[model samples]
Target: MNFEYSDRSKALQEKLTAFMQEHIYPLERAYDDFVHANEWQVFPELERLKQLAKDAGLWNLFLPEEYGEFSEGLTNLEYAPLAAIMGKVYWASQVFNCSAPDTGNMEVLAKYGTPEQQDKWLKPLMNGEIRSGFMMTEPEVASSDATNIATSIVRDGDEYVINGRKWWTTGAMNPNTKVFIVMGKTDPNAARHVQQSMIIVPADAEGLKILRPLRVFGTHESPEGHAEIELDNVRVPASNLLVGEGAGFKIAQGRLGPGRIHHCMRLIGAAERALEMMCKRVTQRSTFGKDLSQYSSIRQEIAKSRCEIEQARLLTLAAADKIDRFGIKEAKDLIAMIKIVVPQMACTVVDRAIQIHGGLGVCQDTPLAMFWIYGRSIRIADGPDEVHMYQLGRNTIKSFN
Candidate 1:
């Protein structure tokens, strides 16, 4: 029941907060401007910021201790607050090499890849020399039930031929995305979950085409845009298959457990920032001859937001602690709880913040609009709220009986 962070975690939180204040916050406007104007190009100052973060020993903080050499030795519980800090700024995680798709992909390679596969892909990803994507959700299927994915990976002599169309491939549009961990059906007749397998395909492999960039709320989410891709007869060596046939489901569960924690914690941070902005804004402006902060409705909204943020933060930490002490399998219910709760909480909180800010909230002048988009988008990402609710309800009923 102890939810207090360890001294190590508290120390890292301070350091990460200071780093954000000193570097990240100052460049927020400039970063947004460059990414919007350049489309698919890295921000000009990104590499320099990355170098500074690395020099500060703030890189790869997402990898837990079980990852061995690749990890920063922090458990999931320890990493939660640091993730919250990075979440305050949308792109802040990448500067420290702790961003997604990459984080999940690295864990896959570290845990399941053959030595050769690790040397080829994992190494580059860990060093931040390249980026990657996870291709699992399909445009034609009810992707929430990953078992519904219809991508086909057929064996062809010394290689595997992949054929499918995937959308919401988060990092696919990034120029530096050098590889993808693709999920496809290798044995359609195998048991429900075992039909699928995960394989690595190079970004430039033949028959791999970038169909288009998908937008969230009309924004391209520049640099690392979500993409719809066509993989037609894309071939890669047999060695690229992770672990073995019938392992994609297992790998995906492992990847998503921690990934959800990261997402929820970041949403908590975004909501916190929104509340701060809302509070600051209400005091500085007056409507109808009185400060907006003095209005009963505004005060109530602010209070509700604070209460919601704290609840979500605590729930996410509980999930993180459960994972650190037990494992993803044992932590499943808590994971589902946080996943079902945090994003919705964030959406409500951020929406209130937007309402309080009035016109500026919908515009790019403040990050509230973007924060709201992220919160709303996450409600469907990773396995939508309804899916988690279904599973959690089933688990709860079974436990009570």
Candidate 2:
């Protein structure tokens, strides 16, 4: 497939890069400090930065052009490099309203929600007036197979009752997260994939409780912390059910395909930044009368990181291009390949950068530590690496047969 980015994509890449350098890079350290010191509260400057992003026309870059008015008129292929630029800083995506859970949630709403449902939630979300959560994983289940999701959504006249516990519900802890797209069983006896359904539940609904903020590598990941939430008999209007009772799995697959592309590209950007840092650090330091850059070992690490980053980036771009030209089903293998490859590559590249940074690596002094954490954590997020590999291996064997 031709992977050359269009002139439009190249123009966006240049504009986004300049925006990041001018505004995001200067405030990176302050943003980190504020989030750490404040805990669930947003860094005060984020709203202003977001307005700047909107004014600069970089907002909602993740939504695909197929969504018409809701989208920025960019294809998945066109959005990939822009996402990579935003990925260099963990919080930068939020500035452009391109962060996940939200991005996935928005896609689901745009694709599946009824007109009224979209009016109520999607508009606020797209306008950056509200945030959202995707509640699917559970503490007791091996959620890699989503059919194992045991949350129950039972119908009752005018409303549906929801009872379940969800952990790693990203964005639930944010004060601005006003809604959740929750997945649960609506018909236990239905066919395997048809048993589950997704419904919208207001974050403030009665009987819903925020159990606690779950930490990743001991950091709160504040402002949008991953949360453990208990939905005890939570109820919402029956109108909130998306598509139909058996459509959860279908909706989820559609939502995740593009989201995975966004995540992988961002990971590549993080890896590129780490490698850049590693190269810079080596040149500025010395050991035993020899520069760190002069050592073959250091040079080898740099070379390996560069090669791995390029490989992952190319693979992710190929996946994006496929998703643009073909449906998600046709691009499934490539999607699974990136899901299996990118995070691991990012983890390895960031680890080498951390090693080069020495003590400063593990500490908050450099973004290297957070980059490593993001790359490593993502191996388990979305779908875990093992699940993708298992599916890909099966697909490969079937192709041969």
Candidate 3:
């Protein structure tokens, strides 16, 4: 019930807010230009910013110590605001090594990897020496129900031979993405959720082909682009298996609790920025000798957006608090609720901004179009809205009974 951010979180927020202003916002154009020139390579300036964030004690703020001794020891509730701040700038998370795929992959390794696996992959990922991707969603299946993942990782002597096609494997296209955390069926006949396992495959392993970068509404999120890759007879040592056979579903479920929170928090940030853009644009432009903000309908739209953002932010905060206090399984309903809610909220907010900006909103001149695309993508990503809604409805009905 206490919604107040702790002093630690408050302090970090001020620091992160300042960091974003000084380093991130100022370089949005430079980062975009660098990536345009490099074509999907990591922005070199990000390395300089990464060092800056590290020096300011803003590194790895996403990993809570519940997994291991490696994190900054902040709880999910504690990290939510910082995530929201990072969310304001799309690329801000990586500078602090708090970005997706890597954060989730790092969590899995910290929680489940063997000591040797930790020393090999975990160390470098934590240090931000290399990047990684999670290969779970398949092009051939309804990945929303992760049980439908059809990849195969069969045992072959001391190594596991992985074969299948995975798409929307975010971060795979990055040159620094040296490893992948892949999920595939090891025992097809096992129980529904227990049939799969997670294994680590090196990016350079034989038979693994990263085909091409996929686009979100014709815009590729370059550098950390989503990739469709084929894993044919890809092999990795047995030691790379996370937890053990039949543990993929368990790991995936655990991965999502925090991941969903991060997504929802970032969505809030995106919506906030879009709303700001909309309000600013509306007031600055006018028709018939009246400011757009003075128009009753435009004011209503702005008010509606503000209300929606606050509602979604509160729900996201509740979900994060639930995960931190009650464990993810107990907080499933809340998590699912926000998963279904935040992206929709962001989409609506950004769409409003786009409408207000008219031609400029949809153009590359503003971040609205890109933010809107990201919002729409998440509606289908991380378990689609329909899936989450289905679960939430069932849970609600069961609760009333």
Best by lDDT: 2
TM-score of each: 0.99, 0.99, 0.98
What's the distance in Å from true for residue 233, model 2?
0.8
* lDDT, candidates in the order shown: 0.93, 0.94, 0.90
Which parts of model 1 are misplaced by more than 4 Å? none
Clashes of each: 0, 0, 0
Better of 1 and 3 by TM-score: 1
Estimate, for each residue in 1-401, the C-alpha lDDT of model 2 and write its tens digit: 87888999999999999999999999999999999999889989999999999999999989999999999999999999999999999889999999998999999999999999999999999999999999999999999999999999999999999999999999988989999999999999999999999999999999999999999999989989999999999989999999999899999899999999999999999999999999899999999999899999999999999999999989998999888898899999999999999999999999999999899898988898888889899999998999999999999999999
| RMSD per model, one decimal | 0.8, 0.6, 1.1
Decreasing lDDT order of the candidates = 2, 1, 3
lDDT of 1: 0.93
Ranking the candidates on TM-score from highest down gives: 2, 1, 3
- The worst-scoring run of ten residues by lDDT in candidate 3 lies at 28-37
lDDT of 2 at 264: 94
Q: Candidate 2: global Cα-lDDT?
A: 0.94
As for lDDT, the candidate ahead, 1 or 2, is: 2
TM-score of 3: 0.98
Off by over 4 Å in 2: none
* Candidate 1 lDDT tens digits, 190-239: 99999999999999999999999999999999999999999988989998
lDDT of 3: 0.90
